[model samples]
Target chain A: MDLFAERGYAEVTVAEIAERAGLTKRTFFNHFTDKREVLFAGAKDFEDSVAKHLAEADDDLEPIEAALLALTEAGLALAQYGDYARARQELIASSTELRERNLIKMASLAVSIAEALVRRGVPPGRASLTAQAAVAVFTDAYAAWTERGATADFWNLMQQSLADLRRAVDAAPSRPSGA
Target chain B: MDLFAERGYAEVTVAEIAERAGLTKRTFFNHFTDKREVLFAGAKDFEDSVAKHLAEADDDLEPIEAALLALTEAGLALAQYGDYARARQELIASSTELRERNLIKMASLAVSIAEALVRRGVPPGRASLTAQAAVAVFTDAYAAWTERGATADFWNLMQQSLADLRRAVDAAPSRPSGA
Candidate 1:
């Protein structure tokens, strides 16, 4: 990441990265397909953990609660990644292509979660909606935790985000009364 | 979109589109920057319309409400696109590069909405959160509306989505006591 931050993602060469870490190019390839994978390396593991939680959840739990349980549990673990997480975030934020890729990754995750919900007998539309909304709350809360230096538990921060959204909606200025 | 979808986004060459439509490639260039733009022709216009709405919204409205108002208005206007919308969506769905571009376009729009909130004195972090949450809600609701043969009002569907999220979060399964 230091190498990336210093040299920019586009300018940094794979060979340079390999040599900088005292590794052969073959060794680097054994670990990652490309530089982008360095920042996204954990996404697959994260997704699997979330999926496992979702699968193990009580079948009767509300879809949102079940998904939130999975996400909060997953987020709690991810929160431990700490500065490494933020640096990855910084790298993503610095590049347009990465930013786009990041959103697609999130979109793809939401789809996977939604598919899991659907397979669990959740209604198709509701599953989709809950999946997207869950991702939204999780991402927002995760950003909060990262930017604020981990002052709060991940689940608690998620609660605050849900709380904030409620406040925003309820406090919405009155629409036309007679419309 | 019909021409592109009938073929594939990449397979349908620009010259073929112009020739089949009895126009010169020059005319196509005059409109779209490239093939993908044909799929996203309305997105820029939609964003501009939303920006206009935000600019006109009551200055005292909360950022979330202001964003909803703008997006709701745009969504209604977008409902007019109909089957062209379906074909365009299918084309983008079929192409990874196009999908990434679309997500970036959506992210750019969210940033624009966030900027409007920032200008209205919303805290930068809060503005970003609100904007992201709003986009999530909007995207979900739009998906709901478009999944079937939707021909009615758009704002109403948005209102339904807002209600759904509020209910889901507020009714979230309570945490186990003393956990």
Candidate 2:
């Protein structure tokens, strides 16, 4: 976020980033294809862990439960990166390019969730819808948990958000047609 | 979309866009502050229609009903631009910068919904949650409706998606303790 605020994403060179990190240019490339990647660095690991956890979860659990379980488990992993997460969030907020990259990463992960379901025998259309909804729940939970500060555990907050999603979707009666 | 794909957002130059539209650059600037606005050209009017429709909507309607009603009504406004909408989607997908711009627009609209509800006397947190949920429903339904060739009307698909969300949420016979 500092680099962006100081010089803008378009203007900052990868070499400058490497020099600042006290790392060689080759080392930087070895870690990330470009500076923009620092924003999305750990997403794949999150996705993989979520998928792995869900695969081992009980089959009787509904897709939403299964998804939330995965999200909670992923949140546990991110617990060590609280400050890093905040900084990354700021970086995404700082640039339009980064935000788009973040969305695409999210959309792609949602697709992965859907595909995982399909491989496990979920209907394709249902898979897509369920996956999207799960992603929605996870996203809402993550956002709520991220900014909740020191009083909350990320995993616990995610669980609450999942519960909130349940109440919002189920307990609230569907709106009448006119409204 | 054509203009953007051909010349890129920054390189397109607003003056050239004005000429293409047979208007002066001054008129273009009067309409938008920058090139990104052109890509989201329809968003403002769409939001206006939604806000207006939502404001006049029956209070008794459930949240899903309220969301679908607004989406369906807005979808009609966008129907004529089906091809254009698809093109815009493509452009946004192809460019991270444009996608982030789109997310900010979405975030703004979500906040607008929350504010509108707060004015209507709903509690702040509930209003925000409901607004975010509404956006999520529209996003999933719109993606389904558009990606599948617009076979179903926008509102109908939204209703289906809402049902799908309900089922997804309720499918879990029981949530875990942490959940």
DockQ values per model? 0.37, 0.35
lDDT of 1: 0.76
* Tens-digit lDDT string for candidate 2 (A42-151): 88988898788878767777776676677677667787788777766766777766776777677778888887777667777777767766776677767766666524
Candidate 1 Cα misplacement greater than 4 A, ranges: A13-35, A58-61, A119-121, A150-152, A171-179, B10-38, B59-63, B121-126, B144-150, B176-179
Candidate 2 clashing pairs, residues 3+ apart or interchain: A175-B62
Residue by residue across B50-165, what tens digits does model 2's lDDT show? 77777877687655456457667766777777777776787777766676678767766777777766766766666766776677678778777677776666666777777776
* lDDT, model 2: 0.71
TM-scores, all candidates, are: 0.79, 0.79
- Please list the C-alpha lDDT of all candidates, in the order they appear: 0.76, 0.71
lDDT of 2 at B38: 80
